[model samples]
Target: MNAIMVMELKKHVQDRGLLFWMLILPIIFTVLFIAMFTANTDDATRQQVILSIVPGYVVMFVFFIMISMVSAFIKDRDKGMTTRVASTPISPYFYLLGKWIPFMCIVIIQVIVLFLFGRLVYDVPLGQPIILLILSIFLTFTVTGVGLALAVIVRTENMGIAITQIVALGGAMLSGLWVPLEMMPDFMQAISRFLPQYWAHQAFQDAMAGNIVFTELMQTLLILFGIGIAGFVIAILRYPFFLKRAVH
Candidate 1:
């Protein structure tokens, strides 16, 4: 399992296109948002805006990992790698865990980098470091689980990538990543409750302000993992059908 996880991480590291989308572009986007959030000269509002939005970028970019995962599954199926993997003695659970855990770690690292970048470049602070860390862990699991399920759901690489964009962008918009929930219509804000992004963003906001409450944090964790559990169940339910098709 460790070997498989390392190989998957190495594969990601070697893919320049994946690197561009997953790493480079996110950092650039964060930098751009830093400028926009800094436009207001008022110190308090500036910090609040930075705290509110920087975490959104972290969650948004982590969402793009779904595309890479879906692409990997499709490409492997096309190239006969999935067939070979299926024939191996390893259990499907181990194989999926090997893939999923690495991406979770990757997203954690990415989120940390983004937060540190915010701190260094913009003097932004996350008042409770542990709270942010906990949120990152839950958020990573939620996103990685979705990525795994998506890998088997799409029939084609193009479809996978297209869906990734729609979900990532649409979820962010609806969940108040691009705009504050208070600024949106009542109906739109109500809709945000269904998205894991909204909870993750709220958790991060609480962490940033050192306002962490155990009940709220636990609630956020539960909602995030609930989404993850649903995704994993869906992936398992469909894996046999997808594997049969891939091997043939």
Candidate 2:
């Protein structure tokens, strides 16, 4: 497992495509979107918009990890790497730990980079540092879980591409990342609640606002944990079948 994780982490560092999605794309979008929205607004309004959208954008783009996750799994299978791993005596749990942990580490770095960018570039008032850190960690767990689940569930590169579009694009739109939830219709708002992105975004927004009520924090934390746990459970249940298919 340690070997598998080290291998994945090294690959992640060298993958220019992964860097583009994880860092470059998010940075470009953040600057463009923040500039576009802050235009013509008063100082207070601009600050408010910056606070809202910058973190929302962070939440939005971190999900692009899903594409990389699916691709990694499929690439390994197609290249016979999965077969090699399966032939070893490693437990499936250790194998998955190797995969999931590296991504979580990647996400933590991604979140910090984006947060620092927002702080220096946009003057985003990160009200509570501890809350932000907690939110980042929990959100990464949720996202990594979803990514791992998709990796096992999607069978081919083509399908992974299609589903990545649906998940990365669709999740952002439905989760109120594209626009504030209050501006949407009541029904759309209701639907947004069901998305993990929505909950994570809400937690981020709350943390930014310093709205750190105990019950509210607990509720948001619970939802994030629940989503992550559910995703991991699905992945674990399906992993055996995935291995069999890959080996065959």
Candidate 3:
């Protein structure tokens, strides 16, 4: 598993496209939105805009990692790499873990780097350091777990890409990442409660505010953890079918 993880990490590092999507694009979106919306705003409003937009884009782009995960799995299947691994003595669980952990690590690093950029460049307040760290960890798990499930389920890379965009962008709109929930219709606000993105963005905003509402934060964490676990369970259950479709 460690060897697979190391090998995957090396490949991921060398992929400029992946890095661009993971890091550069999010920063671009953050800057663009901040510039567009914060113009002529006062300091308090500007700070609120920064707080919301930084975390909003972060949550949205993090889901784009699913595109890479789906491509990797499908490519391995088509190239017979998955078949070769299946023939080896390695357990399927370990194989999945090997594939998963690298992406998880990448996500952790991605979150840290983007947040640091927000702090240093945009003067975004990182309320409580410890809580922020914990939130990032859980957010990583939630995104990657869903990615793993989607990776195994999608038959084609393009199909995976399409679905990922829908999930990422659609969820962002509905969850109020692109706009505040207060501005949305009542129905839309109620629906936002069902999305992991909504909970995550809300929790992040709370942490950034430095108020630290324990009950609300705990509820958000539980929801994120549950979603992640559910995704992993689906991946494990569907993996056998995915393996069966691998080219020889």
Please tell me which predicted candidate would have the highest lDDT against the true structure.
Answer: 3
Clash totals for all models, in order? 0, 0, 0
> What is the C-alpha local distance difference test score of each model?
0.85, 0.87, 0.92
Q: Is candidate 1 or candidate 2 better by lDDT?
A: 2
Name the candidate, 1 or 2, with the larger TM-score value: 2
Q: Give the alpha carbon lDDT tens digit for every residue of 1-248 in model 3.
A: 88778889999989999989999989888889999999999999998889999989889989999999999999999999999988889888888899999999989889999999999999888878889889989999999999999999999999999999999999999999999899999999999999999999999888988887999889988999999888888999989999999943
Residue pairs whose backbone atoms clash in candidate 3: none
Where model 2 places Cα greater than 4 Å from the true spot, the runs are none
Which residue runs does candidate 1 get wrong by more than 4 Å? none
Pick the TM-score winner: 3
Instruction: Give the Å error, residue 93, model 3.
Output: 0.9
- TM-score of each model, paired residue for residue: 0.95, 0.97, 0.98
User: In candidate 1, how many Å is residue 157 off?
Assistant: 1.2
- Every model's Cα RMSD, please? 1.4, 1.1, 0.9
Candidate 2 lDDT over residue span 2-31, tens digit each: 999999999998999988989999999999
lDDT of 2 at 86: 88
